[model samples]
Target: MKRSKSKICSNEHAKFIKQYKSKKLTILFCQLGLLILFICLWEILTQTQVLNVLIFSSPSRIVSTISTLYTSGDLFYHIGITLSETLIGFVLGVGLGTIVAILLWWNESLRKILDPYIVVLNSLPKIALGPIIIIWFGAGMQSIIVMCVLITIVITTLSMLNAFQSVSNTKILLLQSLGASKFTILRKLILPSSLPQFVSVLKIAVGMSWVGSIMGEYLISSAGLGYLIVYGSQVFQLDLVMSSTLILCVLASVMYLFVALLEKIVHRRLGL
Candidate 1:
């Protein structure tokens, strides 16, 4: 009887895996098809002058502009600079935000004291702080990183804190009744239970970090994709602007997909 039950479970699991793989392939193909269709339509419209090539810029023209930048050796430098700042800011913002959230979760009084300030900061426009950041850290990488950090940190902290707090009080109380220390309860129950929210916050932080980095570059930068956009607009080089914007979109999409991949890995490990 036990052997039969085990075999039944195995078959069910195999069937589920087959279905999952089929759905995944379907989604991937659909996404690729939609992107190709959009590009084709864009090129057609531009060729027909329905969309002005000078302003909207065709896919082919954007590709040509990207090639020009690559041949001139400016593409990688700008991308590298922006990429580095965004990544550093992302790491620091998420790290520090998580740490602060843990501390707040551990201390109720401290959480109460800081909660209002966190809300206010999260609601404030990060761009308004650009001039102040420049004053504090100067028109360099330091200022750019600071901008990214500021943008992501508050959101991260609040998100994580809420996740921690939302863990069942009954679970916490049951653990306490079992003589579990606060630290042990956190380690065994709270943190583990908060994994889903942690992944969610990371997804949010990924986009915030990019926005912060680009906005900072817009404010003051000798080099970076954001600088390219600003310069292209000023000189009416629409192709350059379109190309830079396209690259930005691609990079941001890549970052978001990376976070999504991480979410799947974490979910699987936690058996969610």
Candidate 2:
């Protein structure tokens, strides 16, 4: 009787897992179908002249332009330059932001002192600081990197700080009652609890990092997708503009997916 019951339970678990996997596959196929359908409609409209090819630019035209850039050896260089700036800025911004968050979390008085300033900086228009940044870092990669960091860091700090603070007080109190040191409480309790929030913030930061990098390129770059975009507009090559924009979307999507994959791995490792 006991063996039969155990076998029944095992079979039910297997059935549940099968259903879950099937659901995931369904969603994936649905997403792919939607994307393909949209692209087909877009191509049809442009080809039929319902959408002006010069203005809207068909998917085929964008692909052809990208192929041209690839053949000319400009595609990878522009992508590399922008990717390098974005990755560097993202790493520094997240690292420094995490450190600042830890410091603020550690010292309540310091957190209070910096909170208002952080809020003000977050609200301030970063684009207006373009001239100052150009003067300070020169009209080069340094300025572009600085722009990316500026866009990402404050947001990272605030998001992480809030995550740290939102950790349940009962958990901390229990650790305190057990005579755990402040460091121990933070290390064992707070940080662990904030992992999901950290991942969420990382996803947000990735998008902001791309925006900042592109904005900087627009202001001063001689190359990069952003530079391509600005030049394309000036030259009235709408195909070029659409191609660059498409590439940006693809790159941003890839980065977001990478972060999401990391999140899944971390959660699995942590058994969350």
Candidate 3:
């Protein structure tokens, strides 16, 4: 009887996988088709000279621009600076956020006491702090990291709080009935269950961190991608602006992929 059930489960799982693959393929085809159509129209317009290349450069022009920047060494230095600031800020934010989340979960009274301060921080506009951050940290990369950290930390806390609180009452009760200690319940239950949401917050904070870093650089900086954009625009170099924008998108996407991978591993391990 057990063998029969196992075979049935295996067959059902195979069917489900096949159906899921078909749906994924359909979505991929639709997205790819739209992308190709848009690029075709863009290339045609540029080649026909119907769209002014000065304002709206061709895809080819952008590609050539990327090629030139690769040879010039300017792109690498700027990219490195921005990436360093972003990664450092992201790590600090996530590390602090997780620590705070666990601390608050361990002590509800402290969480309640700190609620007001959390609200005020969340309400504050990170962009407004750019000038102040530059004054405190100086007008360069460190200031940018500081700015990004501020933007991410509060949001991370909020996200983690929600996740930490999502542990089911029944699960806690079951563990309690099984003679589980508070520390054990927290370590094995609350923390593990919050992994998915923590991953989500990390992804969100990635974009916020990048935005804060770049905006800080924009307000005051001698290097980095945001500085590149400001300098390019001031000099009417739209190509540089577009290139920086593309690089930002890529950076955010890479960060997002890391979060996604973490989420997948956590979910699979927890059978969530």
Candidate 4:
């Protein structure tokens, strides 16, 4: 009996380890394949001169350009400023947007009253607000933050409000039948049910937050990935343009991963 139990335990452990190894190997292979394909395409194009080395830039040239920038340590400051703007704007927008959502959820009458205003605000191109924000706040971090908030908050608020209100009717009724208070119903039923939607909206808001920050940099103010791209383009420094773009993509991907991790944690905790 003891030998049989030990054998079963060893087999289960081996199977789990094998599964884990396979997953890691799959991820590694995919990354390796993509890297190989990208390098091959770059080398082929450069060899053929079909891709202008100076214009499109070979991968080797871009690496050299990155090394030069890294040695100068100039990219750190630009990256810091842009990341600060993006993170702050994202936090403010999502926080305020959530508050707005909760408030709207609390009062259906208020939501109905403000419905048209919400439509108008959402329909108004957030980019159009850039000039006004600049005029109101006068060209700096404040205007940029405002633009980011303007873009992300309204949409988040609308989505969360709808999601909260759309919680399962049966769930709400069951809570009511248990003589639960409104707060109890919301706390146990509505809020929990709306979490999946919140996670999705958070992902969307993160993208919008990046958009707002970049647009702000594009329209006004001095430093950011967007500014670097514009500056690089004007001077025809394709390497700098490419580097800044890579930085933006990396930053956005990190933020995306963060939200994804949060979603996974939520699912695990809720047993979803």
**lDDT score at residue 2, model 4, on the 0-100 scale:** 39
Best-performing candidate as measured by lDDT: 1
Global Cα lDDT for candidate 4:
0.87
Clashing pairs in 1: none
lDDT of model 1 at residue 55? Answer: 88
Stretches > 4 Å off in candidate 2: 1-30, 177-179
TM-score against truth, every candidate = 0.86, 0.86, 0.84, 0.84
lDDT by residue for model 3 over 128-201, one digit each (tens)?
77778778888777888888888888898888988878889999999999999999998889887787888889
Mind giving the per-residue lDDT tens digits that candidate 1 earns over 1-272?
33323333577887887787799999999999999999999999999999988888889999999999999999999999999999999999999999999999999999999888988898999999999999999999999999999998999999998999999999999999999999999999998899999999999999999999999999999899999999999888899999999999999999999889999999999888
**Any runs in candidate 4 off by more than 4 Å, and if so which?**
1-31, 177-181
Which 10-residue window of candidate 4 scores lowest in summed lDDT?
A: 1-10
Give the TM-score (vs. native) of candidate 3: 0.84
Indicate the residue-level lDDT of 247 in model 4: 80
Instruction: Provide the overall lDDT of each model, using Cα atoms, as 2-decimal numbers.
Output: 0.93, 0.93, 0.85, 0.87
In every candidate, how many clashes are there? Answer: 0, 0, 0, 0
Query: lDDT of candidate 3?
Result: 0.85
